[model samples]
Target: MMNDKSLDIETAEGNAQPPHLNFESSFPSENTQVQTNTSEQRSAYQWYVVIICMVAYILSFVDRQILSLMIEPIKQDLMLSDTQFSLLQGLAFSLFYAFMGVPIAALADKKSRIKIISAGIAFWSLATAACGLSKNFIQMFLARLGVGAGEAALSPAFYSIVADLFPKDKLGRALGVYAIGAFIGSGLAFLIGGYVIGLLKDVNFVVLPVIGEIKTWQLTFMIVGLPGVLLALLMILTVREPERKGLKVGEDGQIVKASFKNSVAFIKTHKKTFFCHFIGFSFYTMMLYSLLGWAPAFYMRNHGLDASQTGYILGIIILVANTAGALFCGWLIDFFSKRGYSDAAIRTGMIGCAALIIPSVLFTQVENMQLSFALIFVAMFFSTFPIPASAAATQMLTPNQLRAQVSAKFLLTSNLIALGIGTTAVALITDKYFENTVMVGNSISIVNAIAGVLGVFLLYKGCQYYRDSMKTENLSKS
Candidate 1:
């Protein structure tokens, strides 16, 4: 049943080798290339790489989402409308985060992923600090764009690198831990930003020699942004790029690189899996950012809570529930696989999607603050439960050279739709459709209910395709 072109190769040490990066030219001799392919020869530093990559991911979200907590200050400072602020939060950042990902991901497929990651970490971290320096709309928008572009470099490379470092059986869990970074960074953005702003609320703005006066929110951005720069140095000095694995090598032993046309062509051969996967998650993301971007304001408006109180409650729920969901289900994917469920990740994702619907819809419709928070908390956990499994499944389906590019495609579609449309949909329903700000809760309910159902349908349809891909993979290995 195996595709003849997809069989495993033998290593110089006489052991079966998994598909790996074509580094034939770099090796200079066939014997050297074969020797490095052995599982026993893998670098001992792999787990450290995963930990640090997760840190970078955490920092990316912190830099990106910090604006969520600082919305009121940004509005007051710029004398801006809600539309203008939303532009900064959604469109401005997402444009770069989406388009810039492809080229960077292509580079990761060919060059030093470690170097790419370090440079990205430094770029985004510095860009986040620069956000504090901007005095006006155009300047701040550019800064946010820079943050997006820099973050675009991280996940594709990290996903590709992580897959090679972790064996297939363990990849779901490793990626699960990596996926926690997004939620962690998101939660911490609110926690750290709220705490910092609260601490500085009574203090007068400080005037610096060149930068002039800085507000409390501005200072918060600068302080949180600097630590990631230090972390970038650790990545460069400590992490070694693992030997690439699970790729198709050519007859001459040359690792063929993916071109845009070819990659699309290859993806089409498995269009059902990719399309269902992309569209499903995109809708899932629509529901997610709808709550995330608007929920704090919703609480403050309806429940008589202040910014600090809203941040504390939402932050704790996001961190604990998302972390638990990602870790537990990620491990569960591997566990199911070992128990003869070849499509375990897809099954887990389907379950998460189904579970997410009711809680996601009800959380917004409820009037009681306690009930609202509890519903949303359960929704957040289930919403995130699918990410690690989806990520690992994507890697399992793609070849080594194409992994980053495909992963980039994954991020681009999900974020562009999520950040671009998800937030806007809720706003449109409230501002345009109902013509009443008080109906924000109803708007959230309508949008999430539709999107959550669609997400469940697509993920369910994609399950068999994921299983088919796994069978193809197993056949290739045999």
Candidate 2:
């Protein structure tokens, strides 16, 4: 006879065996085991979800940027000052979009991200259409506010979704692909706006009791706004909710709730990465947003080009340069990561890009129109190349759990300071020096060049923090 403990162990091991594997069945089916493993992998549809999220992001950007191309026509019709126009493009829009993003992103962390995104698209699309109906500065300002409110839900929620869908190693490429939406949507806005305004230059619609005559600019807003409504419907009807990774299951099998305080705590613990990304992106946005918001008007006034011509030329440049920059940065970051030089890659790329920006901007102020445009294209290409690296750096520094909130925090700082203040600063400078467009342009260039230099310092600091964090993480794992 066997001892009690040995017999008990044998009995427990025997009980652990499945009935099919027991004497009741001589052999178990290999097909059944393979089917279970396949189901596990099928549980998460990562790439499909990334594609859908990217589509929603594209619509968000198109709605925001359509106004950039239409600014000239809108300014002419409304008789608006540069200061007022800047308000519409920057502060009026970015104020709500920046502040509202935090809470909405927090909600995305807790609720269904797909639902938040769908609702946001619908709200903003309707608001864009409402912009067409505005009779005065106040009405247009309010419409822009609505647009901002809707857009606030997009980036953070999308970032959260992307983080969940892709592994750490693949995230740079994933974000690069997603960022293409920004370039494509912005390019399409200018392309479509130019064509529509060109086609409808003489066409006027006299309809409705309250709204008598509608111009092409007004019609442009209405037409562009409608498509997002359909996109919103697609988002709501088709997209399945993804599971929130790293959540704990309780005794009753429900996901244990994560607190906002806990989220803040996580960020506080990683403050170095948080601040570095915030400043680097903030500086980058200051330059990009100001340029995007003002470039059309700048070209129209200084280059003596019609809105349609200016739109086409600038649109083509931005489309090509931005797309290439984003994709290249993504590739470089991923390439360097495999060699254990992720931080070094980001630091070198951003610093090099930032250093070139000063000269690039000065060159854009050159007297020759063709030369200026050519130089601006080069400046834009280099300026935007580091964007993907900055994005990846932000994602790498934060814990996976707080990625969305951290992104929101980064945007809040970047947008409020860069997008909000940068555009306004350029507009104010232009207005003060309105008598001398050349001087005005030079002033704007100087401000941007200084901001670019600051960005290099911030990026370098971020790289150091990233390396230190990686070391700490490695020791923890060991």
Cα lDDT tens digits, model 1, 187-239, are: 99888877887777787587778888988778777888889889989989988
Output the lDDT of residue 20, model 2.
Answer: 40
Against the correct fold, how does model 1 do in TM-score? 0.87
- Give the per-residue lDDT of model 2 (tens digit) for 1-478: 8999998788877886743466734555788779888776654456666667667667767777888888767788888977888899888888888888888878887788888988999999999899999888999999999999998888888777766666556777777777777777777778888888788767765364677788778888888887888888887887777666644344588653455676677667667866776777688667777667777777777778787887788788878977776676667667767656757445645654575576457754778988887777776666665546656666665554565676677777888988788888888887785555434466568667877877777777777776776565451111
Task: Give TM per candidate.
Answer: 0.87, 0.85
Q: Give the TM-score of candidate 2.
A: 0.85
Show the lowest summed lDDT stretch of 10 residues, model 1. Answer: 4-13
Model 2 lDDT at residue 243? 64
RMSD of 2: 6.5
lDDT of 1: 0.81
Please estimate how well model 2 matches the true structure, expressed as its whole-model Cα lDDT.
0.73
